[model samples]
Target chain A: MNFEFTEEQLMIQQAARDYAQRELIKDVLERDAKAEFPADHIRNIAGLGFMGMMVDPKYDGSGMDTISYVLAMEELSKIDASVSVIVSVNNSLVCYGLEKFGTEEQKQKYLRPLASGKKIGAFLLSEPEAGSDATSQRTLAEDKGDYYLVNGTKNWITNANSASTYILIAQTHPDKKHKGINALIVDKDTPGISLGPHEDKMGMRSSDTHSVMFTDVKIPKANRIGDDGFGFKFAMQALEAGRIGIASQALGLASGALERSIAYSKERKAFGTIIANHQSVAFKLAEMAVKVENARNLCLKAAWLKDNHLSFGIASAMAKQYAADIAMEVTTEAVQIHGGYGYVKEYHVERLMREAKLTQIYEGTSEIQKIVISRDLLK
Target chain B: MKILVLIGNVPDTTTKVKFNADKTAFDANGVQWIINPWDELALTRALELKETADSCIESIVVANVGRVETESTLRKALAVGADEAIRVDADPKDAFYVASQLAQVAIGFDLIFAGIEASDYNGAAVGGMLAELLAIQSVSAVSGIQLENGSLKINREIDGGSQTLAMNLPLLAIVQKGIAKEPRIPAMRGIMMARSKKLTVATPIEVEPLTSILSFELPAPKASCKLVAEDQAKELIRLLHEEAKVL
Candidate 1:
């Protein structure tokens, strides 16, 4: 197999790099300090057609390849994971799910706008107790001849406050367990929808996170993504690719951390010599490079599989688990390499270290990823 | 008006320079390739001109002289709004070869734009040479550009100031910064559609080489600075005279 990226993929990577360096980096420190969402950045990303990167061109998306999406994700995450997560949720979770399973009506209304970045989309699955266990979904949606009354509280929801559309997974028949669930596209303006206090997050502060509560929210039957009992399977399928997005983000964070560490080692001096000349500092940088490269290979392989329409669930899970683990490890080491300077927010390693932790916990937790891998492995 | 944008490939600005043991050539092991920044600036300006003055311009095409690898760079030009691209399949040895190959494909274009210099070699000769080869009016180091009734008004950066020049169509300009604020990044949709766009890959016409390289060398590594007490003006002066040879 050719390991080289195609011409289109490389261009997308460069675009993301330029956007991140020019536009995103300028406000990252201030945004993180003030916990601002940078709504304007979302508009800019949409204008660049990044939100609909992999959507079909007919639907107002760029109809790009999955490899391009991964490349863009990597570059965007290298500078600001807070912004990258917004992209991830839109491209990987909401857009992919709707496009894969959405009917003509669903695709026409929600998927189009979400893909074009005219509106923001959020994935609603996790509840207070259902973080990794899909079978424990507590959200309820009662069948109402022509509509469903949806009521649930989804926490740790990215883009919760500002999202116009939500792809929510709720139980229609609790007795049937996972088989009873259904995924619905709910508009934010629907009655009985409200938001809780924004989560006081430690990292990715530029992303708006909150607990979205729905009390007697009514949505037409047309909003159902597929037939009844498709919610659980839909979430599983979406996360398989969503994992790749997270993996790429992790790889980008690791790469950025390694790059910063290399620069710091070259400039900072100790004992009349540059720190990079020291064996210990050099080895740390080496290890960081190794981890970043390994994670990148795993992510690209998984993306390639998905792009070619092959079996990618196992590869995606493996990439997610490995990349997230290394991202956390690398960023932590990057901070260590930075010494006391890294501990402060000004050095940026501390922020990256914090950003790295979310990849391990979200999309699918490391433990959940292990479960996915172990199940596939044993079979 | 039809526009032809001259695109080139150069090593990324950040690639670390590492020479082989004999120092004959650089190791390409991890060197990343990117569109030359100057060419990119020129391409962006041309595309912007087309976008704003769509009624005046008919189409824009990009041309490059490199092997299959450079097709990727040219594809980027297409994604950035070039109507099509023409790539001459050969390694460009020098500005003369590059200019000759470009002039062959650029025959019918009403306007031509290129960056003032490629970042790799800093050889700022390609545009002027191409203009001379094609027997067209040439402008160098252009910045601000505007189109009027079937003609153009452009700013040329001169020594310590900028000058405005009015020229008609079939004009060739080699541009520097201020031609465009920042090079436009190709939107994701543009990139997705770039693959199937009309990219005409033509074989290069043979031409005699004008220059050859002997060997490459990097400047010496910077030496550490010396700190002197505030009262040591005489010592500083003496050191500047003897060590720096600047007195």
Candidate 2:
């Protein structure tokens, strides 16, 4: 099989890189410093058709391949990881889930707007008690004839305040454990639904993150994502897609850090020679390059498998784990290469390092990804 | 009404170039390609025209003269709003060959559009040659185009400003950047539709080349900027006259 990217993929990658450099990089540091959500940046990205890179055309999506989507994410993250996460959650976690599991009417109504970028989407599966064990969620959706009364709290959710629709998971029958979990779509403005105070984050602060509380929220039964007990399955599928996005994010952050390190090392002189001319500094750059390249390759392979409808669950997990670890390693090394300058905010490596940490924590923790890969391997 | 857009897959402008050791050709390694940015402007105008008419323009057909490697560019044109694509499967070393190949496939179209020049070659000759071969009225460096009652109204850039011209149907125009902002990235759904859209490849008629590349090289490095003291305006002017020789 040919591994080279098609011309279209290359174009998307180049366009994303160009857009990121020209549009996103200028204010990334200032926005990160102030913990401001880049609302206008998101609008620009939406205008570029990235908010729905994989959704079908009928809904006004870009309908690009999975790899193209990942490439776009990677390029965007390279300039600013915070913005990348916003796009990732919207396209992979929320829209992909709705398109795959929702009914025809659901696709027409919810998926169309979300895919078209006319509305933002958020996925709410993590609760205070159910961060990793999603089936043990405390949120409940009690049946009330034509509607379900949803009452619960989801914490640390991305895009909670700005999202127009939320794909929320709650227990419809708590006695049945995992069998009772169900996915439901809730409009952000539905009565009894309100956003919690925005979180003060260390990195990716340009993307708003907040808690969501649903108290006696009434949603029509038609809003159910899939069969009654398929919420966990839907969440898992979404997470699988989300892993690719996270991998791309890791790749982007790492590549950006590496690029900065290389440039700095070449420009800075030490002991009458460029730091890059020293074996110690040169070796670090080389290692970072190796990790970034390997991580990118893994991400591309996983995304390709997913796009082709092949078995990619295990591959996705592996890619996510490798990329996350690589991002952390490369960014840390990038900071080290900067020496004292890296500690300062003006240098930017410190910010990249902070951004790299989140990739290992969200989507799936590095530890969680390892477990997933091991389980798949055993199977 | 159907409109045909001729696109060229040219090397991305930001890419670094290298020439062969013997200087007869340029190295192709690590070269990235993109749809000529100017053609994207033309395509956008066509889409805008189609959108405003309230009647779906029958189709926007992109015709290219290249190999299968060019399919991606064709797909992009489709994604950006073209309905189908046709490839004249030949390299076409010169503009006449490309023009003749396009003339063969451009029949039954109300207008033919192209970029002023491919970013790779910067020849800027294909549009004129195609117009000559097809015996149609031609306009080059079009910054704007409008369709009305089977005629094309075009605004083209001249030396310092722009000139507007109108031509009947079955005309040719080569677009320039001042036409419009680069076309927006195709939407997700448009990309999906492009996957199944019709793209036909046909053998191209052979035409002889008139000129070939002899060599390529980087331009000379710029001289270092010299700093002149604020009080030495006279010296700066002397330097400009004596050293830089601009005065």
Candidate 3:
């Protein structure tokens, strides 16, 4: 297998790096402290066609492959995961779902704007009771002939305040189990839609996260994706593709931490020389480097499988679990390498550690990914 | 008005410089190539001018003189919004040779831009040589360029201050930094479109090089820093006087 990246892929990576290092790193600390949404930054990247990088060019996307998407994600996540999560959800979940499953009319009306970066989109799936057990969705969408009335509370919804379109997943018939579920595209301006207060998150606070309450929201039947019972499969497939995005993000965090630790160690003097000259500190750096490299390989492998139209479910699950776990481990080591400075905000390793915690818990929790892997082996 | 940007292929800014065993050639085994920083800034300004409503600038073309490996760097310039590219199939032996190759393709453009120097060699000679060969007026140390009512308004750094000059077409600008805020990053669409943009490979004429490298050596590593305690004024003075020899 060829390990070299194409010229286009390398150029995309450089563009993302230029933007992240030059723009995002400027006010990241202040935004994190204030928990501010990166509104202007979102607009900037959207203009760069990052919001829909992998969608078809006919639908106003950049028509990039999944490998390019992974490279861009990793570069952007290195400086600001808060911004990268917004990009990940829009590209991997909202854009991919519509391009792969939505009808032509739906694509024309809804996907066009999102793919062109004219609007932001969100995926509404998780409820307060259904974090990891996605099959236990309690939100109800009552069938009303031409329109379906939706009423539910979706918890931890990212881009809740900033998105213009939402891909809502709800059950139409509780007795029918998952087969009764349907996914619909709903306008954010629809009446009877209200958002809860922004959750005070531990890290990635710059991302707009809130609980959305849908009460008697009417969505037309024309908006339903795939047949009447395709919501479960659609969500699963979308998340399977989405794991690559998060895996890359986690890889970025680990590598960013290691780079900072290396730079700090060489400059920080302890007894008589720089800390990097000490074997203890140097060995920790080596281990962090190894973990980051492994995580990168896993992420790229999963991306390659998806790009080549192969079955990537198990590979994605493995990547998500391993990358998320190592992100936490590497960031912790990075902090320890920085000694007392790592506990502070300016050093940035502390914030990376905080962000690493969320990667393990979201998309699919580490426990949930293990279940997916073990179940596949047993079958 | 059509604009032509003189592109130079150089190692990435962060690359560690290394020489071959004989010290007669650069060791380029793993060096990553990029557009010269000043040229990138010049291209950025050209794109900005083209975006204006009253712009007379029609299209921007980038030209480079190098072997096929430098095609990627040329393509990168196209990815950042150049309308087309031209590559002269030859090794750029020196500034005069590069300018000679560029002069063959740079004719008929209303305006030509060359960075003051390439990051690698810092020769600072191509733009002047090209202008002299083409029998056109040249502007040096240009930091700002704008088009006002179809005329070119330019800014250049003087000995103690800055000065602005107004010039006509068929001129070459030797640009320095501050030509633009920063080089524009290629958008995803731009990267995709770059694959289809026209990159013409022109035949190089026989030209003798005026200069050749004899040998190469890297500068010595920086001396270690010594810190003086806040209360140790006497020791600091003694060290600076005896060791540093500047007191």
lDDT of each: 0.90, 0.87, 0.94
What is candidate 1's CA lDDT for residue B45? 84
Model 2, B1-247: lDDT tens digits are 8889888888778888788888677677888667887777788878888877636468889989999877888888887789899999988677877888888998888788888888887889998988888888887778888777656678878898878887777788788886777565664446556778999998887677777777777788899668899999999999999999999
lDDT score for candidate 1 against the true structure: 0.90
**TM-score of the second chain in candidate 2:** 0.90
* Candidate 1 chain A weakest ten by summed lDDT: A3-12
Please identify which of the two predictions, 2 or 3, would achieve the higher TM-score against the true structure: 3
Per-residue CA lDDT of model 3 for B1-247, tens digit only, reads 8999999999999999999999999899899999999999999999999898335888999999999999999989889899999999999999999999998999999899999999999999999999999999999999999898888999999999999999988899999999999999999889988979999999999999899999999999999989999999999999999998889
**Superposition error at A186 for model 3 (Å):** 1.0
Question: Interface-residue RMSD per candidate?
Answer: 1.1, 3.1, 0.6
Query: Could you give the TM-score of chain B for each candidate, in order?
Result: 0.95, 0.90, 0.95
Give the TM-score (vs. native) of candidate 2.
0.83
Residue A173 of model 3: what lDDT? 83
Winner on lDDT between 2 and 3 is 3
lDDT of candidate 3 at residue B220, scale 0 to 100: 93
TM-score of the first chain alone, every candidate: 0.99, 0.98, 0.99
Summarize candidate 3's per-residue lDDT along A1-379 as a digit string, tens digits.
8999999999999999999999999999999999999999999998898999999989999999989988999899889999999999999999999999999999999998998788999999999999898888898989999999999999999999999999999999888898888999999999999999999999999999999999999999999998997898899989998899898899999999999999999999999999999999999999999999999999999999998999998998988899999999999999999988999999999999999999999999989999999999999
The residue-by-residue lDDT of candidate 2 on A63-168, one tens digit each, is 7889998789889998899899999999999988988888989999999888878888999998999887777989999989898999999988999988999999
TM-score of each: 0.95, 0.83, 0.98
What is the DockQ for all candidates, taken in turn? 0.75, 0.30, 0.92
Model 1 TM-score (2 dp): 0.95
